[model samples]
Target: MSEKPEPVDYTYTPIGTIHSPFKDIVGMPIQPTGARGIRGTIEIRSDLKGGLADLERFSRIILLYSLHRCTGYSLKVSPFLDPTPHGIFATRSPKRPNAIGFSIVRLVGIDDCTLTIEDVDILDGTPLLDIKPYVPAFDSYPDERSGWLGAVAHNAQHAKSDDRFQ
Candidate 1:
């Protein structure tokens, strides 16, 4: 029998902050795809600004951010789009052990360490953990199956966030 390795604890300091018009969670779009053309800004810390070099080459970027406003968590949750309950890992619900939110947004422009972005779904003043350039070849999977989401995927286009996840 193999011994399981004990998990080590770690912490992450936000490399930047995301600024958006959605000050409150009541009416925000639930996902990037649903928030098409919504303009927002990301302010990278001055020390991390150097990492922004060449990021502009990509038309989009993936943002890993902390759901700072969302508190507490439930292992099983009813996501914003679906009424049925699902395991926290099964849905992209913000209520989780880590409270991390992943969003991909269009990179419109860059000014020093600040970035102009579109298709944003995160809340204003959210703490950003990291950014990665989106590449279709690597990130896109046209034929992938979406499991339970496949049935209600269309709802995403018209769904707006509410206080359910808060």
Candidate 2:
């Protein structure tokens, strides 16, 4: 038998910070759809402001951020929309091996290094790892199966996060 591969450690620096209305996770919307019209701002580091060029052209952008508030992880979790515990990979639970979270939000406007965004569900002061233009052609799959989520996906629009993960 071949030897097992060793686990590797990775490091990433925050490129910016996400500012949202949510100061705690107790009553915040669980996803973008639930936070519809909610506005937020992304303050990019001054040195990285140059990267914002041409990014404003996209109507929506995907934000990859650190779930700084999550201290640990569980392989199976009870997501906001569903009470049934599911594998971490099958659900968008903040409790993960890597505390990373992402959201696709409407890009309202860009000013200097700050980006005005809407439909935000992330926590305030979350560390932004990166941003990418959201292209529906590359991201959407209308006919694909969402497995267990399909049954309760509609509930997301009305779901609010509780302190279960905390």
Candidate 3:
């Protein structure tokens, strides 16, 4: 008989919580692109101040966080922009086993331990995991295949949040 693999558990305490104008789940922007110009603040705990050293040098940063507002998961889901179903990993749709979200937001400023950001699509109070500078020289690609997303290029700028992930 084959033995089942043991479950590995890892824990992370949030360094801070996000504060955004979007309180309700409905009618919010589904992606950062759709949420352009929106603003939010990341309230980092004072103890984490040392970790943020030199963060202000970057113009934009990537935010890895938890989608705490989403309650369930599906192996497959229809994204806000498409009618066809897609594999969970292939789409940026928020429904997942871990409910983790990733976004690249403009760093307007950093005061003390708080970071004021723009292009905020994340929910208020979302648990922030990590932050990294968005370096276009290393991160941007002028030509790349978008897979299923290529079928609906127009939706990227227009899709708004829906309750499908709830």
The lDDT of each candidate is 0.92, 0.95, 0.89
Each candidate: RMSD? 1.1, 0.7, 1.7
Rank by lDDT (best first): 2, 1, 3
Question: Whose lDDT is greatest here?
Answer: 2
Q: lDDT tens string, model 2, 30-115? A: 88999999999999999999999999899999999999999899999988887788999999999999999999999999999899
**Residue 33 miss distance in model 3 (angstroms):** 0.8
lDDT of 3 at 21: 95
Which candidate ranks first by TM-score, i.e. highest?
A: 2
Cα TM-score per model:
0.95, 0.98, 0.93
> Which lDDT tens digits does candidate 3 get at residues 8-51?
88888887999999888888888888889999999999998999
Regions of candidate 2 where Cα sits further than 4 Å from its true position: none
How many clashes would you count in candidate 3? 0
Q: Look at candidate 2 and give me any clashing residue pairs.
A: none
Could you tell me the TM-score of candidate 1?
0.95
State in Å the error of residue 44, model 2.
0.2
Candidates 2 and 3: which is better by lDDT? 2
